[model samples]
Every structure is written in C-alpha cells, then in structure tokens.
Target: MPTGLRASDAPTLQRLCGSDQRLFLRIGQLLQAKLAFTEPALGEIVGNEALKKLALDKRMREVDATSFATLLAEHGGDGDLVLVDGEGEAGWRVIAVVDELGNPLLAPAPAEVGGAAILATLSPALRAPVEGLLHAGGDEQRAAALEQLRYAAPPLSVVSELMPMLLADGAELVRERAINLLVAAGAQIAVIDLVRALQRGDLAQLGRIADAVSNLA
Candidate 1:
C-alpha cells in the first residue's frame, strides 16, 4: 500500500497534530514517487502499481510539496489524479481527474518536465484520417469523419487542426456536422468562431450557434 500526503491531508494533519509540535516526514515514504491521489468519493486506489509504472515511464519525478500544492490548486482542491500514458508521436503523461464516466474534466496540457510531440493522442490510425479531413480530401470522407468525432472525440489538438477549414467547408452537410461535433466537444473557441462567422456575413452559421446555446442550456 502506498501512503502519502494529499490535498486533504493538510486538514487532517491540522486536526491531529498541534501547530507547535514539529512533525517530520519524507517524500519517499509519504508520496512514494510512484503513486497517484484519489479522493475518497471515487474510492480508494492507492498504491496502484500500474499507475506507478505509468508515472515512472512518464518520468514523473518525486512529489515535492510545491508540485503537489500546485496540482491541488489546479484541480480545485478535490478529485483524483490518475496517471494515464498518452499515445502516438505527441505522447503525454497526465496527472488528472475524470468525471463519473471517466472523461477528463479539462484537457491536460503537456508538461515542460516531459517534452513530447505536440498532438499526444492522435495515433497513426487516427492521424491518417484526421489529417485527410483537415487537408485536401473528398467532401464525403471529411463529412463522415466529422460525424464520427461526435462519438469518438479526437484529441483537442486534432480538433483545433480541423477547425479552420472544416468550419468553412463549402458543403453544407460537412460544415454542419463539423459545427455539431465542435459544439459537442465543448470547444469554447468554436462558439466564438461561429459568432465571428455570423459577423462576417455567414448567416448560415446562426442555426448552429443557436444549437450550441441549447446544448449549453
């Protein structure tokens, strides 16, 4: 079993230990260098060996108070930090929280400690078709991929890569699907661009914007 200091541990320490009493600890024992933190609400998963290996592979260094505190603040003080390995050229290592269905509450930004490629999740299978959709391609193939993305959300980087051209696609069907997928993916920038498109006289985008508003509601 892995034992460590967590965001919640501070309060527990305060409750158990007097302020004047010096309580000493070490990161090696408390943080274990290879474990992750999950709040009780999600259930206990401490000392997860697979996650420890994943962390080591990602080159996750020792957990210092500063890093732990920073991550805690970033996490809004409560949640799990499950380490998951990334795939493809732009691989990433993330210490992140997930919703009940296991979706990342926010996208993990590549950390400077581990410099990997740019788009971490787009493997060859995904990269080929996403690139094809973004670049020169038949409208039918692009439309098909755009529709598929609603169920299988691509990495945010891929979504960003496809946004410019697809949003302005000449084919109404392709453009509409692209907008729907973007909205579903919760891309705030997509809504901003949709509004901009309307300002630029693309009145056709108004309905998509309305749909996005309804989704938000």
Candidate 2:
C-alpha cells in the first residue's frame, strides 16, 4: 500500500476511532507508512480469545524481522499486511493493518468479530438476511444489520448493496455510520481489483482510488 488515504478519509477515520484524532492520525501513519513497518513484522489480533488463539496457532509466521518499509521496499506485501475473505473483492474481509513494525494493528471490535473466521466460510446467502434488514426491518432490525457490518464483516455482495443507500441516510449519525461501513468496505476491496477497476475508469477515477488508498500530503 502507498501513503494516500484522502482528506475526505479524515472524517471517516476520525469517526471510526471514536473521534480520537490521535488514534486516527496513527492510522494515517500506518496507511502512508510515515512510520512504516520495521523488521520482524509480526501479527497480533484484538478480537476475542478464539481469534487470538487462531492467530497464535494457525496464522503465525517467522519472517525476516525488519522495518515495514524495508520489507515492502524489498519484498512487497505477500499477504503480510492485508486480509482477505470470501471470493473476489466482493467477499474480502480485512482483519487488521500492521504498524511500522511488522506487528498487525488489531482493532477493538465486538466479541462477535471473533466469529469472523467462521462467518467468512459461509455461503453467499449471508446477503439474504442483510438485504431484508436494510429494506424492511425496523429500528431493531437495522441495528442488528449494522452489527453484522461492524463485527461479522460479511461479503461485499451484501455490504456493497446496503452502503449506497445508507450513505444517503438523512440523519447525521446515520450517514456517519454509513461512512464507517463504507470505509470498511473499501478495505475489503483488493488492490488488484481496484487497479482493474481503475483501468476501466478515466484519470479522475484513478486519482480518487489513489487518494483513497495512498493520499499522502
């Protein structure tokens, strides 16, 4: 990844970090590699115990142990920094982004997020429930759907469809919430897919993607 998350991203990043400007700025550092990952970049997770255990057992890897920038500068992200889920970008689920050290910058998420391991294995039918909640469900149902978005981190087929409408939500809080979900969705999109999409787009669209991913000042 390059250093280029746009200024427009500021609002969403700030909101996602509970308006903690410092934490949001740190994320900026990680995204832009202002403090790129150092050697021995290891992975750690902040989900529930099960996810942690899975991280320890199934996901651990011994690497060159160096600064993040040097690693990427020399070798590139061989799935070391990004997370993937389901098939294609539509089903991608970003777990965590690492810091200047190769250590993953795990997020503080709901206990249910630990279930992401299992959820990612589900069939595409997961969208059916999300679709119902977005279209017909009442307040409680909508809230439930948001939880799914926040923790479960389902496929984009469902997530992509719900977001545009949510972004248009009239209430300020609702729109902010939608923006948060949109940010997560962006993470789900693979860089390769993003590049392909850009190939089909004009220069302006390409610039937007560049800004979205690596908008360094």
Candidate 3:
C-alpha cells in the first residue's frame, strides 16, 4: 500500500529526534507497552512481557530497505499513537503502537466501547462488495470474495454469512477460505457442523457416482 521511504526523510527525522538516546529509548519502550494483538499468532507473543518487549525494539528498527520513519508511516500509522502491524518479515510479529506523534489536547480518559462503537470499528462497509459476490456470484467469484474478506480482516461477525459456504454444494476453495478466516479470527463454531458438512459433501459425491454407474448400465 505504501511506496518507498525517501532517503532525505532520514536526516529530517534524525534532526527532530535531536540525538537524545534516553528520550528515544523511552519512546520505544512506551511503544512496546502499547502493542495490541489483533492477530492470533501475534497474540501468543503479547502474552510474554519480556519476550514481546525484546521483539518490539527489533520490529521498530527493522526498516530493511525502507527507513524507520517510512515504516512508521506505512505500518506505525497516522494517529497520536502510531499503530504498527508487527507481523511482517521482521520485528516482534505483533501489532504495536510504535510511537506517539503528539500529546492529546484533552486529559486521558479511556472509556469502554459500547455495541455501536464495536460495530463502527468492525467497519461493515468493507464487507459489502464481497457479500454481493458471495450471494450471487459463481464459485470463482465467491472464492475471490473470501480472499478479499480475509485480507480486509473484517470482524468475526462478518464470517457468519460466509460460513454457510462451507456446506454449499460447490466452491471448495470458498469453503477453505471461509474456514481459514474463521480460524484466524479465533471464532469457534461447532465441530458437528463441519462433520455434517463433510458427510453431506461425501453423500453428494456418492450420488453423482451412482448416477454415472446407472448411465453405464
């Protein structure tokens, strides 16, 4: 999504830091503390404080070809707290708040999210196009839509409509996509449903086989 980090941006960023290692390290430490685990595998890392902190520093510094400032802009993001998706080739492999761009004007008052707040964050709008294809499109289109949903990382609730594809007569790829997304989201469903789907699928295959046999006869 983001282009290359400009070479000139480095000196500008360094000048802004003013060579204060203590302050810089402190900012880094704060970022380590604020890392949130939206992903499951990354969630496991977040559980370990010392391990996660170690990974956090490396992730922030892992610009590779890109500058740290650029990675910060691309993944660290544009907010008071720059949120970084750590699950790339390098870093802690978790989502982190790499740095705070500026202090908030108002006093810090964190509040619990309500139902509407939760819905807004999930962003139902992202699923609209995919849902359209899932409802009426062919297997290939359905599979592609599922891939899009997977990448988009919609909320667990978004998976409900897609889950039925697992038991659908065709579109094996769509079923795989739906299951993978559900597993990644960590939304548990009944094993019985999956078992039944497999059984039903097998039965359908058997029926087709029986029809072919009858034709041969």
Candidate 4:
C-alpha cells in the first residue's frame, strides 16, 4: 500500500520534526517504502516472547535496519510516535506502525468525524450505550464511555465533544482520565489547556505539560 502522504508533506513533516534533516530523511524513507507489518512479525523482532511463536514474518528489505531500530527504541515506548489519536489533525495516522526490524507504516484514519458521525458507524447494540454515556454520566460512567468510544470513533472525532469540558470536570478522577485520554489522542486542547493554566500562574503543571507537548510533537 502507498503511504498516504504526498510530496507536499515534506515541509510540514520537517517542521514537525523540528527541522532535523536526518530524522526527516529517515521518516521520509520509511514513508516511501510503504511497509506493512503484522503483530507477530513485530513481536519476534522486538523479542516479545509470547509473540515470537509465529510461523512466518515480514523482514526488512528497504529501510536501514539500524536506524529504524533506533527510532523504535527512542520513540516506541509510548504510542505517540506511531499513532495520532482523536485529538490531532484529521488525516493519516503518521508513522502508524513500526516493524521493530527496519520499516514503518502510515495509514489513513477518518478525516474528521464528530460524535454523531462516530456513532453512525457503530453496531446497533453499541449505539445506545455510546449515546447514553456520551454526554451524561457520573464520573466513572463518563470515563467508561470514553473508553468505549475509542473503538468506535477516530481519534480526532471525540475532541470537539470532550475537550476543555472534561479538562475541568468536577471529579478529580474524571479529570485525570480526560487528561490521559486527550493527551494520547494528540489533542491540541491539551496543550492549550496547559498554556492557559500556566498563564494563570499554575507552575505545578509546567513540567508535566512540557513533557506532554514534547510527546505530542
């Protein structure tokens, strides 16, 4: 499969990588190679014992294996480097997969879907639960609802409905979950919320926000 990006993506990607020429080049090479990997293949490569029992695997053929391994080792711990969740720009999930052997894969996600669009794609059985818990629920219920939506909706789809509001949720537990979900989703609101807090002279979260933004970037 072809990587979703076009030539025009170079500039944008370079900026995203902070103009690191080498990093940009490595990312570009991986995109051009258009690699796809299965979980078992990656598991064997990464030394995951349970996953290493697979019969066959996809091996590296194009990209530099060493560099790819370094990339995975550096940014692979958290899902941020590979998966752009609901809160990011509505486009492909940039660098969506890394085989841990030598290559990466980029895949498209829904361009931009709202809560309704997300719900429309769900099975009939899931619709009511998702709908009921979407806007109304206690702290725990809201958290579970968000988790349910993860499977039914694209990363960017829920941002409009859940951001900022969830950030300021009355329950500390709910607010914490919202923070984790939004940050994982790559939501800009997370950063904006942090900046706002900083502006209000809240220094306690400064380091945390910086780390979150760094990962998001």
Candidate 5:
C-alpha cells in the first residue's frame, strides 16, 4: 500500500527534479510510490500547492529577476536577488546557475585537481565523482576527458604539472590519450620537456612522450 504526496512537498521535489533530469527520475519514482499509497508524511512534504506555484513562477522567470518579476509578481525582491556586474555575480551565474564552472571556476581544468582551495580544486572531483572515472577507468572516459582538455587554454605551467600523471599512467591507452590531448592543446614546450625527461633515464615517463614524438615524426 503506497501513500500519496502532500501539497507542500511537491514544489521542492519538482524543482530538484527539473534542475537535474537524472535526479528527477530517481526522486520521481519514490514520489510516485508515495502518491499511490496516500502516505501522509510524504504527501505533506511533496504536495504543497503554494510551493508548486513558487517553483513554477521561478521557472517562468528563468534566471533574470527583472524580466521574471515583470511577467510574474510572485518573485519580486529588491535585494541581491538579481545578479549583476562583478566577478562574484558572474561566477555564480556561470557555476551555480548554468553548471558550466569548468572554465570560469577553474583557471585550468586539470589544475583543478590539485590547485587552490576554490572551485578549481573541486573541478576534477565534481566532473568525475565516481572512482572509476577518477582512478583507473577504461579508455572511453579518460579519452573523453583528454579530448575536453584539448579545448581548454590552461597555462603551460599547469600542463607541466599534469605531465607526470600522464607519463606514469598504468594504461598505455591513457598515456596515448594524454599525449594526444597535450599536442592538441599546443603544449610544445611541455612536450619538449617530457621528451627530455625520457632521455634522462625516466623509463616510467617515456610512454606518453614517446607516443607524442612518434606522432610528430
């Protein structure tokens, strides 16, 4: 016997679901079951008509408070509700609102793994939450991440920082992928340094540099 959702809980749940589709499917399943059984507590939290209206109103407004308020009077607030000007507001809009924080949040995407404490340090973890993606996953995901790296205009110093991981990767495929990414990213100086490291008896670091130089020839 399943329960139904209450009036208050629906809006928040709906908002969360709408924000992320995959999450929505998971929560939607639970909500559906609760709705079927008339679950009092679940219903109370998930079925709020007022909240639902607010969520809908928020959506209709989109991310622009002024335009949103003009169309709908429910979301009128004069404070910092509207993000305008400056780096903080811009960061919030890009990271929190659009979820595209990789560039704006982190100076260089890979440096995000071991850089400062802000969003950059959290970028790698955020992008690849699963251990499989971060640690020793298959070629597919690593290749994908490497491809993304090619498009990023990170500093050469950052590329130098990441060279060791690429050079020491256990998988040949990962090494190859890293070489391709570095080359695509125009890290010629870093490539030369990696080649020099290989010449200095760093056998462990030869794989990626070797592959990259071979491609150059």
Candidate 6:
C-alpha cells in the first residue's frame, strides 16, 4: 500500500499492472525523474497482491523449477512479474508484470544467461534473442548478457556472432567488459578482429581494449 494510492485505485492499478506497456513507459519516465520520490509509487505497483498472486499462478505451469527460479530471480527483483498464459490445449504466452510505476519486476539476467547457454549448446534458433539482450539499454542488462557470453564458450565459427557487439557503440564499461570476457574465453579470432579494429581506429572504445590486447601478448 503505497502512499497516495486509495482502495479505489486498486482495480485500475491491477488492470494496468497486468500487462500494460504504455503504463510501464510512463512509470519509467517518472522513476527516471527521481527514484527517491518515486519509491513509494514503485512499491505500490510492485507490491500489488493481485499481481503477486498472478505471478505465483503462472509459475505453477513451468516444467523446470531451475529455469523458473532463474527467470523469476532475474525479472522479479526489478519489480517485473512474468506471467505465462495458456494451459491445456492453448500454448503458453509470456506477459510481463509491471508495477504501478510500470517498472518490470523481472530482471534481465535469467533470459540473458539462459539464452547464452542455449546458444552455447548449438541451438542456433535461440541465438538472436540472447544476442539482442547484449545490446539492451541498462548497464545491468548488458552486464548480465556479457556474463552469459563469458560462459558461452562459443567456438570460432560462432565467434563472429559476438564480435560486432563487442566493438559496437556502447558505454566504455560495456566494451571493456566484452573485451575482458572474450579474451578470457580464448576467443583468439575475435581478439584479432578487435585488434584490427583498434589498429584502424574504427572503434572509439575505451582505452581498456587496447590495454587488454597489450597484456594478451
């Protein structure tokens, strides 16, 4: 029960919190304005009893608890709830749980890690989504994606898949992180590619990539 939210607001909040993307955007904007001021508002949205119950209900359908737990842990902490709809003859559907403030409770880690692991397992079909998260906006999301990449052990044939991103435009921290992971994973060809990029001055990345390469030799 966040301050300023009346009992009358509950129903509307519940509906919006269910799966409303626009409401989420609005909440994101508000939170960006000031998290301290918005905490109560966020608490109200994330703490909704109905939403929690729905998430629990959705969790019951998962066949794998480890997968479910990972997903829940990733997205749940962010205040986003994931709902899997469809049962019996219907197919399962994913619904993002948004708090009243519109922040998704689900963290991006599980998806990133799971997706990367799937890729490492050579399931080409799962690569795109996992790679997509590598470019996700938040530092935490990018970090999670990079951590997954670190663990992927992708072969040289697939090293190209991640090369572009490691050199793409992003925060210095992200680029540095990517470089470190690639190096540690013994992505030799990828490192060579990065070295080429650095030599051509094609990548305006942080000084760390160059430093990393220097140490590698």
Q: What is the C-alpha lDDT of each candidate?
A: 0.41, 0.37, 0.38, 0.42, 0.37, 0.41
Model 4 lDDT tens row, 1-217: 2223322232333344442333333333333333323333332323432222111112322323344344445433332223222223332222334332233433334442334545666667657655765666688888787666554443544553545344434555665555556555665754555534422334455344444444444
Local lDDT at 51 for model 4: 25
| Cand. 5 TM to true fold | 0.29
**Candidate 5: deviation at residue 122, Å?**
8.7
Provide the TM-score for each candidate, comma-separated.
0.32, 0.27, 0.30, 0.32, 0.29, 0.30
- Output the lDDT of residue 172, model 2: 41
Off by over 4 Å in 3: 1-125, 189-217
Off by over 4 Å in 4: 1-129, 151-153, 188-202, 207-217
lDDT of 6 at 66: 42
Candidate with better lDDT, 3 vs 6: 6
Give the per-residue lDDT digits (tens) of candidate 2, residues 1-217: 2122222233343333442333333343333211222112222222223322323331122222233224333433443453322322231122334442232453324533312333444566564445444564455556556656556566555455454344323344554554455556554333332333322323344334443433322
Tens-place lDDT per residue, model 5, 79-194, is 21222212431211110121222235424444445323233443463333222334546667766666566555444455545654454444556666666655655666534544
Off by over 4 Å in 5: 1-136, 193-217
Could you tell me the TM-score of candidate 2?
0.27
- In model 6, the number of clashes is 9
Give the least accurate 10-residue stretch of model 6, judged by summed lDDT. 1-10
Q: Write the per-residue lDDT of candidate 6 for residues 1-217, one digit (tens) a residue.
A: 1122211122233244444433332332222221111234334445664433333343334423245446556444443433323321123232333352333453334544422644655655436545665447787677677667556655555544554434342455666666655565566543554444442344343133434433333
Kindly indicate the candidate among 1 and 6 with the higher TM-score: 1
Taking the tens digit of each residue's C-alpha lDDT, what string does model 1 give over 20-131?
1122111112222333233321122223433333333323344443464454444344335434433211222224344422435433344511212323556765665554
